[model samples]
Target: MCAVEDHPHGTEEWWDRLGAVLFGPWAPQAQPGSGHVHCEPDWSWTLVLSDYDLWCVLGGIGRARLNGQDFTVTSGCVLMLRPGDEIEVRHDPANPLTVGYQHYTHGAEHRSATVADTCPPHFLPPRHVRLDDLSEVRRHLDGLARLRRRPGPDTRARVTAALAVLLLEIHAQAARGTGALPPLMDRRIHDVVEWLARHPTLRLGLHDAAASADLSADQFSRLFRRETGQSLREYQVAVRIRRACELLAESRMTVRQVAAALGYSDHHLFTRQFKDRTGTPPGAWRRSV
Candidate 1:
C-alpha cells in the first residue's frame, strides 16, 4: 500500500504563496514482486496543489490501474495523476518495480491543477512523458535527494528551491502534450514542431503541416495522431488554448487582445473553442478563476 504521512513542515500555506511545494522525494523505489495488489480509493491532496500527485518510474515495469483502467509503466515514465484518481500498482514478480515520486502543489492559487499553475478553473497534467533519455531527470532527482539529506540553516530552503526547479523542468517537458517524444519524429518534422511550440500563434495550412513530415496529408494525419494522441487541428487548438489561458490569467490583456495574440482570426472562434475545452466562456472563465 502507498504510504500516507502528515505534511513534512509546519504549514503547507507557503506553497500557495510561492507557486510550489515539494515533499516526499522518493527515488530508486522498488517493490518486491510478490503479486500483491493494493486497492483503495486512496487518494490524497492538499489545498496547496489541489490534490495532484507527480510520480516517476525509474526502473523495471509494473501493471497499474489509474481510475480503473489498467496500463503498464516502465522506466523513465512520469505521471501527474489527478488528486482524486484511484490507482493500484500490481507488483509483478518477474521484473519487479522501481519508482520515484514526489508530491507537489503548483499554481499561484488552487484555480486549477494545470502544470504551469496558470490554467484557470481546473486541469490535469498530461498522462505521462516517456523519456527515452533520462539524464536530465536523473540529475534533478539525485541532486534533490542529496541536498535534502544534509542539515544546515539553509538546507530546507535549498531543497525547496531545487524541488521547484525540478518541477518546472518536468512541466516544460510535459508541455509537449501529445508531441513529447522527440525520438519518434523525423528530423524535418521535429524541427517544425519545435518551431510551432515556440510560436503557438503561427497559423499553418494543412499542406504545411503535412510537408513538415514529408508525407501526404492523410499519412501525416494518421502519423500525428498515432504519435501524439491528437489530430492536427486538435493539437493546434490545444497550443492556442494554453496560450490564451496564460495571457488571460497572468496579464492585463483583455479577452479580445488575448484572442488576437493567439492568432484566432476572431473572438467568436476563440470563445467557442475555449469554452469547448474549459467548459466556460473566456470572459466568464477568467472571472471565475
Candidate 2:
C-alpha cells in the first residue's frame, strides 16, 4: 500500500521541459539526446506502462511490483507493466531512485484526463515480465520524446518507427521470459542459438539440434525449450523469418530464392508464413523497406 505519487516535475526538468531550454546536467547536451527523460521520481509511481505508456530504466536500481510479480532492476532492465498492472515503488531515501522513461500512445488516440480512450483501458502483457541487457531499447524512448515535441514532415512517422522498436523489444523479451529461456539460462543453449542462426538453411529438427549439444532428441527438445523458452519448431520458424527479411531487404533475391535459402521448399508456404508473422507479404514488405 506504500505507493509513490506521480511526479511529472522531474521529467520536465530532465528533458528541459521538452522545449528550446538549455539541457540540464542529467540530460544530454549536444547530441540532442533521444526525446526521453532522465527523471528521479523521488516518489514511487503506482502505475508503470499503461496501454499508452512505454518506459525504460537507464540508471539506478529498484524493485518493481505488479499484482503477482516483482523485478530487480538495473541499468538495462525493461519493465512490461501492461495496462492495470500496478508497479509500486519502495526506495531508499539515502540512495535515491532515478528512472529513464517515455510515455506515448500505440495508435491509441487517447489523451490525458480521460480513460475513455480508444485502446483498452487496461491491457496486460502476456505476463508481467522483465527483460535484461536490452541496450538498443533506451534510445528509442529518447527518439520518441524528441520527435513528439518537434514539428516537421515525418514527425508522426518518426515517432511510429521509434515506437515499433520499443514494442518489438518488449515482445521479444517477453517471449524469451516464457520459461523457455530463464534469465539464468544455460550456456549450451547459447551455442545452439548461434548455430541455428548461422545455419538458417540447415532445417534442424529436435534431434539434429540436440546432437550439437551431445543431447538425445527428446532430451534436447525438453532442455532446449526450457533453456530458450521456445520449442524447436517455433525457434526455427522465427530464425527463418528473420533471415528471410534480411535477404529480402538487403539482397537481390526473389521470395522463392529467399525461401529456398531458409530451407523452405515451397515458396508459397513461406509467403503464407511470412505474411502471418509480419502482416505483410514478402514482396511488399521488401519494397517498403
Candidate 3:
C-alpha cells in the first residue's frame, strides 16, 4: 500500500535535484561544456566520446551507430556508450532531438557499465518501456546531480547502493521479458487461504487443499508462493501460531488442549514450533500474557 511519489522532469535544476538524491557526480548538466555537449541535430551526426555516458532521449526518435552496428533510439530509450565507442544520431530534419547526457567517472564509470551489462537484452519491449517510469534510474541521475552540486562521502555510498539495486531490477525485468501478471486460476487458492484463516484448528497440507484448486501439489505450492509472497505451508503455520497466541491470551485452554485444537497430535512438537517462531514456549507465552 505504498504510494509512488511524483517528481517532474524538466530543466537542469529539476534534473540537478534528482541527481543530488540519486547519483553523486554523474548527474547530467544542463549546459554544454568540455565533458558535456548539447546539440540540436539537423539530420544526423556521429558522436565520439572519451568517457562512457548514459543518454536519456528527452524528445524525438532517432537511430545510433554503436561500435560498428546501428541501433534505433527513441523517446524512453537509454543509450549507454562505452569509452572510445562511436555513435550516430539520425534525426528527422523537420523535428530535431534534445538529449540529456550524463558522464560517469572512475567508480561511477565501472558501476554504470556493470549495471548496463547485467540488464536483459529485451528488458523494455520495442516501444512500450518509458524511461520516465524508471524512478530508480532517475534517482541515480539525481544523486549524481546532487554530488556535483555539493560533494560528500555519505552521498556517494548512498548513490552506489541505489544504482546497484536499480541495475538488478532492470536486469530481472529484462530477463523476464514482460512485467504482466498471469491470469488468476479461479478462487481456489483464495478459498484455501480463507479456510486456513477461518479454521485455524485444522492442520493444513498440500494434499488436503490441492483438490480445492484442482492443482497438482507442486503447482499449488509454486502458485501460492507467487501469489502470497510466502509458501503455503509457511502461511498455514503463521495462521496457526497467531491463533495459538489468541487462545493463550483469551481462553483458559491448557497447552495440551490448545495443541489438540490446532490439530497437533504431539504437544511437544507444537511447543517446539511455537517457541521457534515466537521466541518463547507456549506455556511461557501464556503466563506472560
Task: State every prediction's TM-score relative to the real structure.
Answer: 0.41, 0.42, 0.40
The whole-model C-alpha lDDT of candidate 2 against the native structure comes to 0.59
Q: What is the lDDT of residue 46 in candidate 1?
A: 22
**N/CA/C clash count, model 1:** 1
- Please provide, for model 3 over 1-289, each residue's C-alpha lDDT reduced to its tens digit, 9 standing for 90 to 100: 0011111223445434434533444422222221223455555767786654566665676767666766666655656554566877787656566565565432334455444333222221121223434444556556656655675767656545544444433333232233332233337777888889998887777877786788899888888887788888888888999999999999999999999999998889899999989999999999997
Model 2 lDDT tens row, 181-243: 235456678788888889888877676678788988888888888877789888888888998
Worst 10 residues of 2 by lDDT: 21-30
The window of 10 residues in a row where model 1 has the poorest summed lDDT is 27-36
> For model 1, what is the error of residue 36's alpha carbon versus the real structure, in angstroms, after optimal superposition?
20
lDDT of each: 0.60, 0.59, 0.59
lDDT score at residue 99, model 2, on the 0-100 scale: 58
Give the alpha carbon lDDT tens digit for every residue of 1-289 in model 1: 0111111221234334324333222111111111112222332212322354556777666767666566777777776654456766655565665665665444433234445333322223354555544557767877866665576898655755676666545644554333332334545556656777898988777788888768899887777777778887888898889888888899999999999888877789999999999999989989987
